[model samples]
Target: MALDFQRPDPSSPAAVASAQFTVSRRGYREEEVRDFLRQVSVELARLLERERFLESELKALQARGPVDVAAIDEAAVTELLGAEAARVLTSAREAAQAMRDRAAESAEQIVRDASREATRLLEESTLEASRRRSDVSGEAEQELELAKQQGREMIAEVRAYRERVLTDLARRTEEARRDLERLVHERERLLGAFERARHAATDVVGDLNEFDQSLRGTGVTPPLVPPDAPPPPRASRSSDTPIFDANEYAHELGAAHREERTHEVSANDVVAAEVDPTDLGQVDVSVVSGSPATQTPSTDETSPVEPSLVEHTPVESSQIQESSLASEGSQNTEVLPTSDTPEHIAEVVNIFDRQRKREAPRATPIHDAPEHPVFERVEAQPEHEVVAPVTNRVDEIFARLRTSNTERVAKETIKDLVEPEKPAVHESVFRLRDEVVTPAVESMTRALKRQLSDDENAALTHTRAKRTSLTLAAMFSPVEEHTQRYVESIHETITSVAVDAARSLSDSRRADLRSTVARGEVMEAISDMLSSDLLRPLHERIASAIDAASGDRDALATALRSLFQEWKSQRLSIVIADIAHFTYARGLFLGCDGATSVCWVVDPNGPACADAEDNALAGATTPGEHFPTGHQHPLAHAGCRCLVVPLDK
Candidate 1:
């Protein structure tokens, strides 16, 4: 509602309505306050209508006529006025109480409405705040999950990178170690070769000296002897001394030198210088070369280049070479007459002579005999016959000239084509093994190494693709393809060894064996044997090895490496042995063949156990009449080194 009041500036909200009050004893006339009274009457009427329920009883009593206060009545009027005043007083008190009750009800209702509005606003704000908080929390959780995922990926990447670095470092380190070992091994080999050459030269010097001394005693003009060469360096002894042990070579040939020391004679006394030549098988041929040196001109090629058992101290070939080279440019070179010698032997002798002629001269040829092959020219045959008789004589002279190396086989005990190993592999077996098994095993190992790398990378990268993998079942599963390749390589090596062994027999004998059994049948049996004895065991061994490695990748690789090496080395040996034994036993199967019967020879010197040796010996001979089965094969087991020897009737 709008209201206006009289003021000095009525439009301003700060302006106050003002009125002057004149205090007097008399009351103000009604006419003077009529406007204020009329305003009051209208407000009073509106207020009564608003509180009509509270004023119903007052309205009912208002039906009585009005009594004016100015109309004075004496005693009668005084009593009547008293009763009316009492009734009006009662009505006014009742109306005032009802109005207070209504006001209280209105105030309570306002408070309740305000309280409800405030509660609704508070609830709405709280709900909106909760929703925003929830959204932010959800976003934060998503970001945290994303960061965790990124961190895991980064860790995997870093770990993979670390693996690569370590693997490279390990490979380089291994290569360097192998290189160092190779260099050290080469150094040792060179040192040994140097020592052996020095010893040989020392021996040559001593021999030349002894030859000159013998020539002087025999009344031939002795050549000037060479100065003694420096002693060969020796291996350090337990006492750390550089001196060598007693010369075993010199000791063995002490008999030849004993005669020289025992008999001293004048140069003119040929009879006294003469010694029995029977004990000197190594002596007879030496002076014959010098005999022709005294006289030249034997042009007869068939003149039995007169080999004699001339007992004299022999000269070293090195000295012969030295003397030869010194006079090579001065003399007409000999075209050597061909002799009936082995082709390989002739080739070797030719090479030796050519080498001697071309090599640096070690000693002067001032006393070289004209009979020396280099000085005397011989007419050579125009064909395959290459080495001449003079070359043969020179070869024989050189053959006995140095320390006899016959000690290597002088005793029957050391006579073997090749020594048998714990698991015997014939030396000839290597002819095919190098071509087949070794390369296969190497490739297999390389494949395994690659597999290890792949599996390792897979493990690093796929850690959480499904559930975390904790075991090795997924890593090193055995590959059948690798095993098959392994089997084929072994088959190739063994088959080749067996075929070569059979081919070694005479053609008729091979036919006899083939007649006794079809070739394919024999091979099939052998194949079955290999499958059972070799391949099955190989697979089992690999499985056992993998199982033994547990879950460790390095351990698995190490086990595989060792197993592959064994397959290449020891297992190959066993396979070759069994195949060889089986091949020879084939001929022995039928008595008509070259082999009459077969027996197992357990090397007394081998590593075979006593029980095994005895068992082998007990069943050594398998008669041709009673053909042997696979069970009777000479190879008892993987490590058995027994030999199958065929006997003729």
Candidate 2:
């Protein structure tokens, strides 16, 4: 049967001390049992007090937060009872059992409460973590959206800027075209004037030749015919005629007189025509005189003939006609009477001799007559005013054509065309920067950020390695695109350079036909230039960038920055160098400043310099042959900063 024992108050130390236990056969003595019971009761009360204290502390801990129930060792508390409690409490076994049951129940209740509280707190913490994760995800999404929007805005701005640049380029090109037209017109005018002058000079030469032939046919030596004139054809000589034939002599005299009359008519025709300065040396005034007697006067007789002081007076045609008619009438009426005898013939001859003598002094000089109107008009003109109006017109035309301003306009036009192309290259690079590089870098940055947000224990080395590999792999396509774009840009630039070069050559009056560059040749040259100046260098730079970017995040950013900078600065320069190389290979020689700069040191005695000097001397008569070395070809050494300029030729 179970015994119902009244529980003692653990707070009463006296009740615990006075506790008793019933004795039985073969059991301990009553006094000893009672004493053991007292001890057991006291220990039981102490254990109860400890249980209550632990329960209160556990409740306080539960109020604060979730308790670590696993940390609370109940087995340790049981060990604190020791061997004395087990042995002595046996005599009061029922009571002891009751006490132990109560203590275990209290301990189990405390443990159950702590476990429930801990579970509740764990659930709350998980809910909080879930909420925080959701917030972070939303914020990240917003940030990403904002980044995309900014990227779009940036692209729009870039497009607008490009449009502005293109507009400015178009305007400049139009201005250059107009200037080139003006230069062309001026050049054509000069050429036309030169041709006209040449034709006029030829006409004068033909007229002088005809006059010389007339003088030779008339058996009169012309004083004006140069020694270089062809000798007249000689007639075959007959051995039978030892003396002169009278008929031949008379025929020669008659021909001579006819030639004189022809010459007089020709002189009149020439004076009536407009004369250019180019015709001045062609006209022979000495051939106009008809009488050989007047031409071959004795030196003593000529010395005694006083210089005739004749005024340049205008003479009427009617008065000259009347004088000529009166002379003819007087000659007709004074004809000799019929003379069959020698005495009558001598008398008639004497009368004619006196008549000729009287008429010689009365004859007017050729300068005063309508008979020699051409000579009279020529003698009346001032010596200084001999230059024709055509000459002055030619001089003015040439002066307008030969201006330095025209040369400057041509040079500026070429420069504008060539220079605008460089900016196009720049724009292409900038587009690559915005479209390809910027997006790629942004993606990489986001990937890095995502990687950093992973758990601390995450495989950092493996993750970074994988990320770097992926980034580098992805970079290849963009790099290839960039290379292709840059190649195309370079091609366009080179093509423009070729066009500008051709235009310059065409504009240049001194451009040599042998040196004229063809479009096909320029294209071929560009291909050659691509290998050395564009493709190889670009590949090396991109490869180096990839290699550098394979490190930490900082290293990657640095490499990307360097790559962009190289594209902007170095790559554009490479394109320009390629263009220059193309121009050089196409026979468009460029001038260089030989002074020490980034390109090369100018050693006066160097082979290149010597070659340049020799070429300069050889092409001295040809303008734009100044620089020796860099002028002939591209001076594209590694890291060279030399600017190749198109020579004027």
Best candidate (score: lDDT): 1
TM-score of 2: 0.21
- The CA lDDT of each predicted structure is 0.45, 0.42
**Per-residue lDDT of model 2, residues 480-592, tens digit only:** 44344444534544444444443432444223322344424555555545555544664566467557656565554334434433444445444543345344333323222
Off by over 4 Å in 2: 1-91, 116-120, 127-131, 168-190, 201-649
Over 445-536, each residue of candidate 1 has an lDDT whose tens digit, in order, gives 44434433343334333332356443434533444443444445445434443444445444545454344455435555556665666556
Off by over 4 Å in 1: 1-484, 508-598, 603-631, 643-646
For each predicted model, how many residue pairs clash, with residues at least 3 apart or on different chains?
Answer: 3, 1
